[model samples]
Target: MSKIFLALFVIILVVFFILNINFPLKKHEIYGKYVNRNFDKPICCVEAPHTEDTLILYEDKTFESKFYGAGTYILYNGINPEIELFYKDFNHSSSAIYKTYFLNGIFEKPKIMLNADMNHYYEKLD
Candidate 1:
């Protein structure tokens, strides 16, 4: 009976190890720096001010933005995966606001679109 129990335990451990190796937890695919694609800038001007609005998403589920301020974000996974940003403050002013934006394109380089509008979107920076 002791030998049988030991064999069963070893088999279970091996199965668990194999499953863990084959299927791991999915990492956040949207963690990266994204810049507003519509920001106008001079192409020929090397000294042009870098005033493009930027959004930075951290691995810890926190995000910082030039327009929306710093706060935590939730990524809703589905057929139409969306990201909800809870703004803590903006421009030193305190206000509680949350905005939902749709994600488009591939996982490697996604465009965060406003209200499903493709024209108004932030492209992930490589």
Candidate 2:
């Protein structure tokens, strides 16, 4: 009985540690390192760090930018992949996209959706 209890306890501890832990942590900053000359500089980088992921743009509302967007980011393809992230909008999807080296173009195509009709995708000039 003592051995069984000890084993169960160890298993629980391992699981607990695994679930609460993140690995190969992709360290990112609130402000991205790069800048775009033509477009407005990105307002800010997300606080959450990720090694492999995507961000979708949408029309309006402040979950993110002025565009509707979705993301489905997973770091691996295992029973317990180390990372997980995603977002999506049914009507309009990602148009401007970002690519990563690891996925090798399989999940490489990020997109930006131009939501002009729904709620005035962009603010109008007075």
User: For model 1, how does the per-residue alpha-carbon lDDT over 27-120 read when each residue is reduced to its tens digit?
Assistant: 4557889887744533432211135778898989888876776788887766566677777553456655465554553333576764233255
Q: How well does each candidate superpose onto the true structure, as a TM-score? A: 0.57, 0.24
Q: Residue 92, candidate 1: how far off, in angstroms?
A: 4.9
> Highest TM-score among the candidates is held by which one?
1
Off by over 4 Å in 1: 1-27, 39-51, 89-94, 106-108, 115-118
User: What is each predicted model's overall lDDT from 0 to 1?
Assistant: 0.63, 0.30
Model 2 error, position 54 (Å):
8.9
lDDT of 1 at 82: 67
Candidate 2 lDDT, tens digit per residue, 18-124?
Answer: 66543322222111112111123233333222122233222231123222243434344232223233444435453333222111112122111122122111111
